[model samples]
Target: MSGSEDLLELAVETAREAGRMLVDKRPVDGPDVVQTKSSPTDVVTQMDRAAERLIVERIRAARPDDAFLGEEGGTSAGVSGVRWVIDPIDGTVNYLYDLPDWAVSIAAEVDGVAVAGVVEMPRRGETCTALRGGGALLRSATGARDLQVNAAVPLGQALVATGFGYAAERRARQAEVLTGVLPRVRDIRRGGSCCVDMCSLAAGRVDAYYERGVQAWDVAAGSLIVEEAGGLVGGLHGAPAGPEITIAAGPGTFEALHDLLAPLDPARD
Candidate 1:
């Protein structure tokens, strides 16, 4: 089996390469739309496909036997038991609007478990990385520093971040859940990017994050980072973080937020 450090190195390098490609190719007016998925507003751009291709190609060149699960390219089975989960652009809306919350996310799984992860935000000039047991860190022009979630913040004082789905029905449900969550917390932020939101939690930029309709590629890297940074990342009903829901936060805030969200049925749509 390949070591976690080896996988992390590849994840970080590929993420950085994809990030640079995305930044250089992003047009001033935004990328050309390829097609829509779950909704008309849930768009996929040419850059999204191109970036996924680049990342898959680079990783394949280094380890041809490894499998892949990409947001844009979908999945390809392999025999190596190491799979790369990738989101070429985690915040497509922000990237399209020239916002700074977009990122390239990559996580390497060994035998169906994430062991290494990377999230690269080119616009923010930041890269977050983690190994399953090693811990998480943020790297930028300034330097590299270990990351940690803000300690056990009370639920009411927690600055929470969350995202909504593209479908109107889902959005409405999410909004309904928010009506209950907003008044209880310090404030709510809709960053429109799961990886960015999770990275923010790891970096102490947000006290917690939860979203109802995220995919594996969206949270794979960010969740690992949060876990390594001393935060809990999970779903409702004692489930692992998946489409049903994903929530991340420090100690006290995690349980409080979970209990609060559970009663609200944030997963319902």
Candidate 2:
């Protein structure tokens, strides 16, 4: 297998293992299995911990010298060759509420660029994977199929997806951008999961997606999937993606949407 192929296989395995753990142990009722991270509103749960442990363990076993950065557990440094970025459960709140939109996201970054990625939605039985120069895939028990974003959406008629940030100040800014764009778009959806939102854009379920104050793990895997699927991934200001924020959309609508969001200015506003 090629290098990308090997990374893709590892990503698929890690994501599926994490997804299985989440599906089997997700909290359905009672008080949520919750713990605070950066703040009270930024929560983690038993499912998140279990899934992260599984993914970290698997990646460590496969490549013991590589570093890891995970949502629930924080970071571990290692050799500089490869870094695995993992968000074991991308929608902890949704999962805790018995919602089916959460995912297990994993990405292998080589020299700071994600080369292989996987996002596994256990409840949906869908595993989306992408290799840097290859393409994206939507795999399930049903079958595996190549994936791509829609190329025909017009700026005025596009459907968009987004999420709210945990911080009140950031949420206020995001709301302002939403208010500006909501009236011009065909529709807007707040699905509570960044990974799923990007995947939806990749699969043509939505035409655009944007968010602020997201961690690397939340968007790393999904961003690559969107790009490999023939979409454009960037920051809200139309800059290249970094470790903390993301904005992505179909080819036809990305520029227009970027222009509309430029006034919000995530860096200075």
Candidate 3:
């Protein structure tokens, strides 16, 4: 069986390759839309599928027995304990618009627990990676550096990062929830990508992050990055971070945001 570091190495290599492919083949006019899901604003692009295929094929060649859960491709079962959770393009809308906030996120889960993860932002020219117990690191053109979340920031002074759902109803409820969250914090940033926001939190670019209606593929890699960076990533009322809602922040900031968000019931769509 492969070790955690081995999985992390594969994730990093695959993510970097996928990021390169997406960037190189990107059309000057933008990518072609494959279709939309859940809502019209929730889109899938041809590059999304190509990236997922490339990632899965590359990893499967090295670890054929492993499973997969991809955002573009659905779940595929395997006998091996390792299962890859991937978001080929975490911010398709941003990518479609030629924005730089999109990312290629991949996480290797052993027996349902993510042991290693990578979130590669090609446009930003940075990659974030973490192993089970290993600390998170950010790699860029200049060099690489270990990542750490901001110190225990009070909720009132926290600069929170977040994203909205694609559906109109969910967006409406999220906006309502934000009305409560906006005034309580120092300010808010809607970054358009969950993995980017989580990585931003890990790199101390943002004090905290919270979002509703995110899938496992969205947070699987980024959450591990945050936790490994000496932060907390979870749901409200002691739940694990998942689709209902996911929040991440440093020590005091996590609890403060959690307590503040619990009453708002941001989970409701």
Cα lDDT tens digits, model 1, 126-152, are 999999989999999999999999979
Q: What is the lDDT of residue 59 in candidate 2?
A: 81
**Comparing candidate 2 with candidate 3, which one achieves the higher TM-score?**
3
Model 2 bad stretches (over 4 Å): 28-32, 236-238, 243-245, 266-269
Model 1 global lDDT (CA atoms, 0 to 1): 0.94
Q: How accurate locally, in lDDT, is each candidate?
A: 0.94, 0.84, 0.94
Each candidate structure's count of clashing pairs? 0, 0, 0
**Steric clash pairs (candidate 1):** none
Displacement of the residue 79 alpha carbon in candidate 1, Å: 0.5
Better of 1 and 2 by TM-score: 1
In the order shown, the candidates' Cα RMSDs to the true structure are 1.2, 1.8, 1.2
Overall local distance difference test of candidate 3: 0.94
TM-scores of all models? Answer: 0.98, 0.93, 0.98
User: C-alpha displacement of 161 in model 3, angstroms?
Assistant: 0.6
